[model samples]
Each structure stands twice: as C-alpha cells, then as structure tokens.
Target: TISYDCDTYGNPIEAYYAETFTPKVALYDGDTFIKYIDSNFVVWEDLRRIDYSYGLNLKTAGCNRKPDNNWDSLAKILNPLTYWTNVYSKDCYSGAYSLSSSESSLPFPIMNSSNVNGLSWRGSEDGHYFFTLLVIDPDFSYCTLKTQFSVSITGVPLLVSTQFLIVLSTTLAFILVLAATYFFHPSKRKIKPL
Candidate 1:
C-alpha cells in the first residue's frame, strides 16, 4: 500500500507490511442478529437493534416471494448503486422507506463507530430491494458491491390497496341503495291518524 503524506500530491511514499489483506467487506449488526452476505445476496434478521428502520423491515417474521420478470437481471438490479444521508441517527436506517437519491458516488460507508450509518433500505411493503456497499481500496479507488435481499415480514399493512378500497366502496354503495328503497317504499308506510 502507498500513502500520500500531506495531500493528494504531497509526498509520494510506499510502505510494506507483514499483514495480508484481501479485498473484502463485512456488515456489523452489533451481534443482535444474523446476516447473510455474498456475491448475490445480503440478508440480515432480528436487527431490531436498528430501531428507526421499522417500516423498512430489517427483521420481518415470515414474508417471502419468488422474483418475477418485473425484476431485471440480478446484476443490473443490484450493482453500481449508491446512497447517502446527512441526517443519519441510531434508528434512521430502519425508518427509511426508499432511496432518495440515484447518484452512484454515495455508497454505504462502514465506519469504526458502533453504528454503520448512512445507508437506507426500501420498506418491506414492496418486497425485494437492491442493496449495495462500496468496496474502498487503500489507494482510494472503489467499486460497488451489490446484492438483492428480501425481508419476510408477517406484519399487516396499515392500509389496504386501491383495489380493496374500490371493492369496499362499491359494496357499501349497493347496500345503501337497498336500505333507502326499503325505507321509502309507499307500500310499507304505516301511519295512524287520531
């Protein structure tokens, strides 16, 4: 590995070390849960430790589905992406519902801090999502490590879909019409005059 002492072009220097390093990356869930990561997938469970990420589904009980044609090839869907946030806090990751930016320069950064801050995931309401980590080289050049991961959440939706709303509205309207007709019918009127 080489280091530029003062600045990008300050003092060109080289150093050799006995330790060996392979280009690799790992996620830290603070031991509160387990995660699976590889060339094709990155999954974590029981990560409720990330408090704010509730709706995003870091640890869903039992939600799963097979990928469909709607999803592009895994390579295209997961690779070459980046995300960032200046408002990162303890539970912010779990609070995120979707990616806000599309630029590829802001990959998720792993820090020495207890929290691996600045990455957000799409909430489980939509199913599978694209996740990416930046593989930074000692020399500063980097590429994105990408994967497709799903969250299985047995939780129920806060609101039903549009189709459900439409059906329910129609049913209520029909019932209202029947009740109004029954009450207004001339044959059913009963009046007593003194």
Candidate 2:
C-alpha cells in the first residue's frame, strides 16, 4: 500500500513508502489499524486482537499465533487474498500489528514494517490455511478503514468437469505408448560372449 502525509486541512503534505509504517497519522493512509488519542494525550491503545470470541480457532497446539505489541489483532476471518493480523501493540505515540506464526516471532519484511497487515485463509481440503500480518497504527475514531482482497483456486480432481475427457484421453494415450516402449523394446537381449 502507498503512504501520504496530510496537513491539518487533510491535504497531502507528503507521500512515500519507505521500509516502515509512519507513526504519525495522515489524511489518506492505506493500513488496517487505526490509532486514537484522547484529551489527556495518552494515545488510547484500544486496539483489538483476533475475534476468536466466536467458535473460531487460529493455530494448533504445537504452533501458536504470534502477537505484536505495537499493533493489536482486530479481527480474524477466512479470506484468501491477504494474510491477517492476530495481535497488535502500542508504543506511546504509535502502534502496529504483530504478524507472527508463534508468540513473539515476526516475519521478515517483504515491503515495509507496515507490510505486516492481517491473517487470512482459504477453504482447503486439508482443512484451512492462512498467514498472519502486522498492521500500522491509525486514527480509529475519526478515521475508519479496512483492507480487503479476494482469491480464487481451481483444479480439484474430484471436481473435474466432464469436458476434461479430451485431456484425459491424450494423457492416457501418451502413457500407454511409454509403457509399451519400456516393456517391448527391440533391445530385449544383447550379443552374448563368444
């Protein structure tokens, strides 16, 4: 996602995507977490973790979900497009998501520190799979934002269409030829010692 700084009037003051999420909130920031500051200037770190209150579970026993101190996990859902954040943290002025496979472990940065956004998954036969990401802090009160994406998977052998007969026939023919050649090769025997 891109970044841009805005003035008090909410105008674009600067724009760039470095290797981290800007602690200072901006006019149009593309991140998941939204930070808020109260009258006392105590950046109210009211970030939410995964919404596992429901009957949803994230990791298994051996593998536990990681948590971030800068940002907090707001919600967890089944989405294939993007990985979701399971934990969030705060650091005085700013905060971010904790994208970890286990407690306290963080994934490497592919784009920037803010790159860690959220956790998501797709319905798989083996059950389900998803990755966790970290989200940058934000202004949640006046600024409400959400990141969304989609994914599509195909080629389930059990769900093959009847029209796949053409391809199957070609594959079978090729395999038959290979088997015939291997078993009935002309080099069945070589010249014996004189």
Candidate 3:
C-alpha cells in the first residue's frame, strides 16, 4: 500500500496519514503495439494515414486494489487525471528548443479525450515529427507520466498504375514480336546441307 504522512504544525503528534494510487500509461496503435523504426523513432510513409491509441495498464497493487465495482469510482474520486498530446518539430529535451515553447503545428486535428482511440493522422510532407502523450494526476502533478516518440516521414517511389502496366505490356509484346520475326525468318536462317 502507498502511505503518505503530512505534518502541518511541525509536530509529529498532529501528523496526517493517507493512502494513494498511481496510474500507468502506455501508447498503442489500435489493438497492436505501435510500430517503431527504432527504440524511440517511428517511420511513416508519405501520403499514408495511421490511427493512434493508448492503454492504461493499471494493475491492482498498493492502494489501487479495491473491492469489485469500487476501484473505478474510488480512483476517479481520488485521482482525477488529465491527458493531453503534444507534437514538436524538434527534440526539446535535447535542447533543440525549450520544452515550454517547442510545440509544433499539428498537421491533423486530435480529439480531446483520454483514450485517443480512432485519432487519425496523415503524413503529407517528409520530415521528422515528435509526439508526446502525457497523463497528469491533478492532485499530485509530480506524479505525471509521459511517453515520447518520434516519427520520420519518408517518400516512397511512385507505383505504376494499372493503365501504365497495360501500356508497358503491350509495348513489350510488340518489341518481342519484331525481334522473333527478325531472328526466325526463313531468309535470315541459313539451311544446312540437308
């Protein structure tokens, strides 16, 4: 269990004791884990869209282990949480920009919700984008949790469309016919002494 002691009058005899809970946070893409290019980077193809989601892997431990049907109510009453997302063009933690002033322009709109499910985003330009998912315990801001990740949007070669493929196949067949006729003509092939 999580125990906290508070002394208001600088006297041990008047100390207050209480129990608290801590929440967990994890980033997800629908039901699957987010695909990462590396430990902290993700790759997004040009013109491709992706949906982001998250999960709270809160386990029963400490002061969180409450009786059935009471855990949710108690947690909500005790730990009113807040969730938000941030996007950045550069790494603020590495001093590329100040954390307070480094928020980048969002390419797509994000819903204001705790779950973040069905939040769709499409990468239109090729660049490096950083994202953060933050959860704050309103009662104790110091207990906030955050997950940071980066996405690198890269350009992909254009694919030949169906029309292009048909045209290419017709041209190749015509060339093959010309080559066969020139190579296998009776006049071009000399007859051996039969």
Candidate models: Cα lDDT each: 0.31, 0.30, 0.32
Q: Residues 1-194, candidate 1: write the lDDT tens digits.
A: 32222322223212112211111334535645343332222222212223212222222211132212211233234332321221111232343344323321222223312323322333433222222333322233233333222222223243467669888999999999999998887685578898
The CA root-mean-square deviation of candidate 3, after full C-alpha superposition on the true structure, stands at 21.9
Using lDDT, rank the candidates from best to worst: 3, 1, 2
Q: Which candidate, 1 or 2, would have the higher lDDT against the true structure?
A: 1
For every model shown, the clashing-pair count is: 6, 27, 0
- TM-score, predicted candidate 2 vs. hidden true structure: 0.23
What lDDT, from 0 to 1, does candidate 2 have?
A: 0.30
**Number of clashes found in candidate 1:** 6
Per-residue lDDT of candidate 3, residues 1-194 (tens digit): 21222221111111111111111234456678753211122112222234321212112111122112232243234432221212221222232332111122212121123322222223333434344434423332334344444443345223458559888999999999999998887685577896
RMSD of each: 20.9, 15.0, 21.9
Candidate 3 Cα lDDT to native: 0.32
Off by over 4 Å in 3: 1-121, 124-129, 136-141, 151-188, 191-194
